[model samples]
Target: MKKLLIALLTAASLSACTTTESFVKGADVGWLPQMEASGYQFRNRDGKRQDALRILKDYGINTIRLRTWVNPSQDKGSGHNSRDETVAMAVRAQRMGMRIMIDFHYSDSWADPEKQVKPAAWRGHDFAQLQKDVYDYTYDVMRALQSAGVAPEWVQVGNETRTGMIYPEGHTDNWPQLAKLINQGYAAVKAVSPSSKVVLHLDRGNDNQWFRTWFDNAKANGAKWDVIGMSYYPYWLPGRPDYTASIDDLGRNLNDMAARYGSEVMVVEVGGEDDRPQNTYDMLVAVQAKVRAVPGGKGLGVIYWEPQGARSWSHYALSAWGADGRPTKAMDAFLRQP
Candidate 1:
C-alpha cells in the first residue's frame, strides 16, 4: 500500500470529506509458526484456539513483520528464519489481508548493536565482494517474495542496528562501508518493487542524539532510505525511566527524526513485560497516541514485537500471551479506534 500522505492526495480540488490514512497497527510475530511447532497455541477472546494470523487479525492488527537471516543453517539450530521460511510466513500474512515488513538481519542469526556476526559465506570476502554479496542476496530475496506474490510493503535493511550491521566491515565506526551496504539493500528493494519503502532501523526510541549522529553520518555517506524504524522496549531500554517520561521522550525523538529526515517513522518493535498486563496496555495506549500526534502525521505506525510468543526460544518476557493460551490485555490496545 502507498504511504499515508501519498495515499491521501486524491485530487487537486477540495472535497468535503477528508480521506484518513490507516495507521499500521502491527505485530512482529516472527516466532508464531515456530511456537506452534513447539505445541504453543493461541486462543481468541472466546478461548477457542485459532491460527495465529487469524487471532492477530481479529485483534485489529493490519501488518506483520518477519526477519530474514542469510545462511542460518551455517550453525546448528539456526536456519528456522531462513529466506524460504520467511517467504512462507509472508505468504500466509498476505493471504490474511495483512501487509508485510521484511527485516534483514544480514547475518546467520540475530544482528544487534552488540553482535553482528558476518554470514559465513561473506567472512573472507573483500570489501567489493562483500558489497556485491549484500546486493545479490537482497535482490534475490526481493525477487523470491515477488514471485511468490508476497512482495513486502516495507523492507528494513537491518534490525536493531544502532551501531550498524555485519560486524567489522559494516560496523557503525566504519560509516562509509556501512552506508554502502545500506544503499545496496535500498537499491535492491527499489529494483524489485518501487512501492516498497526501505527502512533504516535502529534501537532506542528515546535517543534523539543517537539518531542525529547516526543519520547525519549515514546521509553524508550517501545512504538511501525512505523510512526510519525504531525499536522501543520500555522494560529493556537503558535507564528504566518512568513510563510517562519514556513515552514523552519517544514522541519528541520521533518528531525530531521525521523533521530531520523528511521521512515517516514507525516503532517497528515494542513490548513490555507480560507480568503486568495493565501496565503494558497503558504503555501501548500512550505510545499509539504519541505516534499519532507526531507533526504532519509523519508517525506511521507501532508494532508489538513477538506479542503472542509463548515458550519462546529466547524466554522473552514481553509477549502478551498468558500461559492459558489467551491473549493478555496488552493486545487490546490495538483495538482502539484511531
Candidate 2:
C-alpha cells in the first residue's frame, strides 16, 4: 500500500500541474516521504498520542519532531513539561510509521533566539560541569528513548540555537565553550544511536553570514553533524515583504552552505496564518512555490508551527485573523509543492 501511494505521488508529481520544470528525481523519490507536517504540543496527557498520530497519518505526514527540556516546571510561577510526554509522543508517532526527530533544547524552558534559560539543575555549573551536564542530559534522553523503544532517527542537538544554548557558560558568544557543549551533545547522541543523523540547526536560513559564521566556527572546533537545518518564516524573518526574493535568497544561501559545510538541509519549522485564512493560504502557496524551486530542494520539508494555536480553535476571530481556522493557506502552500 505504501508502494502504491508512492507510485501515485510520483505520477502526480510528474503530471500534477505540468508547468514547473522537474529539477531531479531519483529512485529514492518514491520511497522518499512527502512532508506534510504539523506540531503536536501535548499537555502530558496519556492516550492522546494515539489520536494525534492517527491525525498525522491521515494528513499524509511521515515525520515527527519532538522537543525535550530538562525540567520545564521547577521554578515558581512556571508550568510543567515532561520528557515522558515527549517520549510518549515519539512512540505513538513511530507506531503510525512517522519518522522521528528529537529536539534537545538543553534548557529548562523554551529555547529560542530570545530565550535560552539554563535548566535550574545545571545553573552555576562551571565549563567542565556544563559539558558534563550537556552530555548527561542528552545521553539520558536518548537512553530513555532506547529503553522505551522510541529511538529517533534524527537528533537535533539544540533548538533555534541562534546564540548557542546553555547560555553565559556555553552561549554562542564564547565559541570555545559553545563548541564544547555542542560537541558534548553530539558525542552523547552518537553514543546512544551511532546511526542517527545529528542535525545542527540555526535561524535565518537566508542570512549568508549567520550560517557561514555558525558552521565555520562549529567546524573549526569540531562540531559533528550530518544535517544543516534551519527555521524560515518570511513573516517573522528580518526582510522586506518580497517573499520571492526571500526564497530565492534561501536557495542561493542553502547552496552556498551545502558547498561550504557539506551537509543536507531541511527547513525544520515554518508556516504563517495572518488575519485571513484565504490570504494566509495565498501567501503560503506563493512562498512554497519559491521554496520548492530551490535547487536540490525536493526533500526539504516544513513543519507548520502551532497552526492550531489554543485561542484559535473555535472562534478564531480573536482579533484580526479569521474565526474559521484549520490548516490555513500555509498548508495549502505545501499541498501545491512538488
- State each model's CA lDDT, in order: 0.86, 0.64
Can you give the lDDT of residue 98 in candidate 1? 91
Each candidate's TM vs. the true structure?
0.91, 0.76
Per-residue C-alpha lDDT of model 2 across residues 1-338, encoded as one tens digit per residue:
99999999999888865542322110000100111122333221222333433433343455777677788764321333357767776776677666778888887767888888888998877889889999998998899899889777778898888888888886877888888888899999999999888888888777878889889889888777888877766667655364555777776776777667667666676545455556556655554454455456533555544443423332322111133323333333434535
The root-mean-square deviation over C-alpha atoms between each candidate and the true structure, in angstroms, is 6.1, 8.4
Error of 2 at 232 (Å): 0.8
Candidate 1 per-residue lDDT, tens place, 127-178, comes to 9999999999999999999999977889999988898888899988899999
Minimal lDDT window, size 10, model 1:
12-21
Q: What local lDDT does model 1 show for residue 182?
A: 93
| lDDT for model 1 | 0.86
Question: Which stretches in model 2 have alpha-carbon errors above 4 Å?
Answer: 1-52, 74-80, 239-242, 279-299, 313-325
